[model samples]
Target: NRALYRAKFDAVTARLSATLDTVTPPAGFYLWPKTPVSDTVFARGLLEKTNVAVLPGSYLGREVDGINPGANHVRLALVATLEETLEAADRIADFMAQCYSA
Candidate 1:
């Protein structure tokens, strides 16, 4: 299970790196990728277009002085199977490519 998870995580991270910046956490089930737009907007569009749901990073953190550190990111949970995670990453890359290509 650990090897499976690491392979899935690495594949997804590589796929998403084409468009969104991702940090390789020392250990975690979630990927925090920086979005090109507002995190909420990005999350909504991703769900609507690709049928992939992610938590807007803003929802995971508290606002400090009207600034949410996670406002420009989204949290992608790689808890699915390897195939599913890869598919999600492809969809995300395609969606973001189209978004910024325009």
Candidate 2:
């Protein structure tokens, strides 16, 4: 059972890594990371606004509540087409810029 799990994990990881390598974010933003994780409000917002999806860091057990888990970052799946990903990146960059400016 473990062997099967490992095999599937390895195959998915390898394919995901290879996919991430070829992706390019807009001009300012970048991929969160090449890992399997969960989605967050911020990530969800991006998906809703730009039709691009991302996993939030909290979803990866980084910012769990009621249990201090230290610093945990999220991994994003940038498996969308170049155009869609770029659009999403642009939207995210703009949103972040506005948030910081405020």
Q: Pick the candidate with the highest lDDT.
A: 1
lDDT (Cα, tens digit) per residue for candidate 1, span 1-102 = 777778877898888787888877878788899888899999999999999999999999899999999899999999988888899999999998887755
TM-score of each: 0.94, 0.42
Runs of candidate 2 with Cα error greater than 4 angstroms are 1-30, 33-41, 44-51, 62-74
TM-score of 2: 0.42
What C-alpha lDDT do the candidate models reach, one value each? 0.88, 0.44
Q: Model 2 over residues 22-74: C-alpha lDDT tens digits?
A: 23333322344432222355566556765656555555453445752422233
Instruction: In angstroms, give how far residue 3 of model 1 lies from its true place.
Output: 1.7
